[model samples]
Target: MLKTLGFAIICLLLFGRCAQQVSPTGGKKDSIPPNLIQSIPLNKTLNFKENRVELFFDEYVVVDNITQKLVITPEADNPYSYRLNGTSIVLNFKKQFQDSTTYTLNFGDAIKDFAERNPAKNLKLVFSTGSSLDSGRVYGMVKDVQTNKPLFDALVGLYNPTDTLNPAKQKPFYFSRTDSSGVFSIENVQTRNYTMIAIDDKNRNMLFNAKDERIGFLSKPISAGVDSVSYNILMALSDNTPLKVQRTLPKVNNYTVVFSKPIEKVKVTFMNKDSLPYMIENGEQIKFFNVQPHSDTTLVKLSVTDSLETSTEFDQKIAFQAPRGKERQKDQFTISSRPENNRPLANSFSYRLIFNKPVQTIEDSKIELITDSLTHETLKNFKSTWNETHNELTIEGKSFAKDTIKWEIPKGSVISVEGDTLARTLIKHPVLNEEDFGILRGKVIGADTSKLYKHFIIELMDDQYKVIDRQYSSPYNFIHIPQGKYFLRLILDLNDNKRWDTGQVNKGIQPEPIIYLPEKTLIKSNFELNDINITLPKAP
Candidate 1:
C-alpha cells in the first residue's frame, strides 16, 4: 500500500509540471528572422552595362512596399520597373542607361521581411553605365530654426531648379535623412547645379505642400562635382495664402472665426440688415465680441469683409440663449503673482495684472511698490513692460531678500497707451518672494553683420521636454530666465517678425526652419549666465 501511494504522488507531480509547461501562463519566446546576406553587382557600384539587377538574402525574406521605399536618384524615366519575386528584388530598365552618369537607388525604411516585418534601414544601391560614378556628396545639419536644436529624421532632397515640375507630383533626384545629431548626407551625386531643400515630412508623402507642409530651401543653385559639399538646412514656414475662417460659433454664447493665417488687421462690426444680425470682419483671425441681448434667444449671422470691399458670406447661423442662474460679477482688474507662494527672495517671482476688458493703455505714475518692513522706501521706481500678444503687464524692480513684499497699484494712477483712464480700485499685496522669479540670457551671432536674424525666439525646456519658459528678442538680444535646469532652444526669425508661422499647402510654400541647440549641452541653474553664441548659416 505504501509503494502504491508513493507512485501516485510521483504521477501527480509529473502531471503538474507538464501542465505548467503548456499553459498560457508560460512566457513566449521572441523570434528573430534572418538579415540580408548579399546582393548582386554590390551596393554603390558604377559603370554597369546590365539591364537587370538582382538582390539575394540568406533567409526567406519578404520585401515591403517597394514602390514607395525605392528611389532612383538622377531619377529614371520609368521608376516603377522594379519587382520582388520571392526572396529577390529585381530591377528592370525600360530604356538604355545614360552615358558617363552615376545613379543611386535608395530604399528608405521600406525594405522589410515577409514574416517579421523587420526593416532594412537606408538600403541603397549605386551603379553607373559610364566610366566613373559621380562621387559628389552634400553634408549638413537640420534643426528647428527657432529652438536651435537638432531635428532627427528630417527629409533632405535635391532637385533640378529648371525642371518646373511640382515637388508634390514628382520624386526627388537625390535624398537623404537627418540623423540623431540632425546631420544628413546625400552621396553619389552627379556634377550639376541643383536646388537643395529640407522638409519635415509631417505627412510622410515626400512632397512639400505649402498649406500643410514645412520646407526649407537654398535660395540659389548649388554646384556639386568631384568633391563633397557641406551645408546646413533650415526649415521654415511657407508663405502661402492667408488662413481662412472655417466655422463660426455663437451658439455657446461664444463665437470664433478660425483663420488659415495670423490676422494682420482686424475690424469687427455688428450690423442688422434685412432682418439678419451679422458680424463683419476685415481680418484673417477670428474676432469675438459681446452680442446684444434680444428677448430669450439671440440670432446672429457671420461674414468676412475683405480689403477689396468684397464679402465672403457663410450659410450657418448662430444662436445664444439666456443663462438660467444669477450672474456673478467681480472686479475688472485682477492681480496675480507668478510664484503664488509670496516668496520674495525667489528669482522667478513677478506681479501680473489681467484686465477684464482690453484697456487702452497703462499710466506709469499709478503703479507703486512698497516693502513689508516699511524701512525700504526706494521701491517706487519699478520698470513695467506690456506684452500685446498675451495681454499681460510685467513689473520689474529691485530684488527682495525676504519672503514677501508689499505692492500697491492705486486707482486712476495707471493710464493706457490710448490715454484711457483706469477707474478700478487700488490692488494691494502684502508678501511676494524669490521662488516666484526666473531669469534668461543668451548671445546671438550672425553669418555677417548684414545678415542677422531679426525676430528670433529663445525657449527654455524642462527635464520632461516641456517648454517652461519662452522669450523673444531682436538680433543680438539677451534674455534673463528663471532658475531651473533648462534646455535652451532658438528659432531664426526669417521675416523680421517675432512670431512663428505655419505653412500653406495650395501655394506650395514651405514652413520656416526651426533650429535647436545640441542635446549634449544644456542650461543649468543658479549662476551668472554666459552668452550662448549662435552662428546663422547663410542661405545657399
Candidate 2:
C-alpha cells in the first residue's frame, strides 16, 4: 500500500509539472528584437514572381500595424494582408506587382518579439521582377531651420517630376524615414529625374498636411542615377492656410472678430454702406465699437492679407447682444513700467507707464518726481505723450541724475476711458553712469542691400532669452546693456511688418528667414563687443 501511494504521488507531481506554465526569471531581460531567420522567396530576389511570401523569425513574433509601417516604394495600389503563423508571418498580395520593376518593402518597426515587444530593426526587403534591381540611392540629413537641430523620423521622399500628385496630398514614389541622427538613405530607387522633399509627418498617413506638418524641398529637381546624391534639408512651417474669420463675439458696446491665422494687413468695412470704428489687436483679432446701436446684425466685409501677400475676402454677419443679468466683470486696469529691478535708466531712455486700457486723463499736478527722497518736482517740463493707442505714455525731458529716483502718482491722478481710477503708486529707478554698462555692435551679412533700410531687425537678448534692446538695421549698436551674457537674433522682416512671419506653402513662400548667433556673447562692463558678423542664407 505504501509503494502504491508513493507511485501515485510521483505521478501527481509529473502531471502538475507538465500542466503548469511559468516564465524564466532572474537573468538579464531580453532587450534585443527578434532576428529574421529566413524568407520564403528570399530577400533581394531578382526576376521574382510571387503572390505570397513568408518571413521566419527565430522566436515567436507579432506583426504590429503592418498597414501603417509597411512602405512599398512604387507604392502598391492594393495593400498586402499579413498574418502570424507561430514564428513566421505570411504576406499575401491583393494584386500582382508592376512588371519589370524593382520593389522595396520597408517594414518599419512592425515586427517585434511577443515576449518583450522589441521591434525588429531595419526590416527592409528588396526584390525585382526585372533582370536587375535598381541600384540608385539618395542620402541626406534633415534639420530644423529654427532650432538648427537634427529632425529625427522625418520622411524623405522622391517623386517623378511629371507626377501630378501633390506631395501634401499623396505618398511619394519612394521614401525613407530619417533615423535618430536625422540621416536617411533611400535605396533601390529608379534612376530618373525626381523632385526630393522632406516632411515632419505628424500623422501616420504618409501625406503632408501643410496645416500640421513642416516641409523642406530642393529648389529644383535632381537627376538621380546609380551614383549616390547627397543634400541637407531644412524644415520649416511652410503654412498656407487662408485667413479666415473663425468667430465673431458681440458685446453690449463692441464686437470682436477673431481670425483663423495671423495676418499682416487687414481692412474691415461694412458691405451695406456703413462705417464703424475698429482697432486690430495682435494681428489676429479686430474689435469694432458700436458707438450707436446701429443694428442688431450687420453685414461686414473683411479684406485680409498675410505677410506672404496672400489675400482673401470674407463676408460675415456681426451681431450684438443686449446686456443682461449681472454684466460680466471688466478686465482689471493694470500698470507696468520698463527698466525695472536695479537696472539703470540710461541717457535717452524714457520712463514710460503702460496701461491695459486707453487712458483718458492724467492730473499732472498730482504726479511728482522725487530724487533720492529729498527733492520733489511735478511732471511739468516732462513731455508725457500717449501713444497712438493711448495705452502707453512716455515721459521724457528732464535728465534724471544718477542718484536713485522715484515717480509718484497720488490717488485719482490717472483715469481710463472706462472710468477706472489709478491707485496711489510709486515707481523708483536709478540713472547710472556710462561706465556701468556695455555696448553690443554687430553687422548682418548676405541681406539684400536694398531691403536693409527697414526690412531687417537685429535683437540683443539677455541670457534668459528676453529681448533687451533691438535695432532696425545692422551694423547695429545696442547701447547701455548691462554686463551679462547675451545672444543675437536676426529677423528677415520680408514684409517690413516689424515682426517675423511664418511661411505659406500654397503660395510657395517659405518663412521669413531667422538666424541666430550660434554662440553666446559675453558683455563686460565698460567694454564694447564689436564686429559680430551675422551671415544670412539666400532668400528662398
Question: Using lDDT as the measure, which candidate wins?
Answer: 2
The sequence of per-residue lDDT tens digits that candidate 2 reaches over residues 340-447 is 645566545577877766676888887888777777778865777876556777887565565777778887988876667877888877777788789888787765
- Specify the poorest-scoring 10-residue window by lDDT in model 2: 446-455
TM-score for all models, in order of appearance: 0.60, 0.81
Per-residue lDDT of model 1, residues 190-300, tens digit only: 777777878777776788766555567666678876675678766655544433566555533334566554345443333433121222233454434333443333233
Full-model lDDT for every candidate? 0.58, 0.78
Report each candidate's C-alpha RMSD, comma-separated, in the order given.
8.5, 4.8
Kindly state the number of residue pairs that clash in model 2.
Answer: 1
Quote the lDDT for 63 in model 2.
84
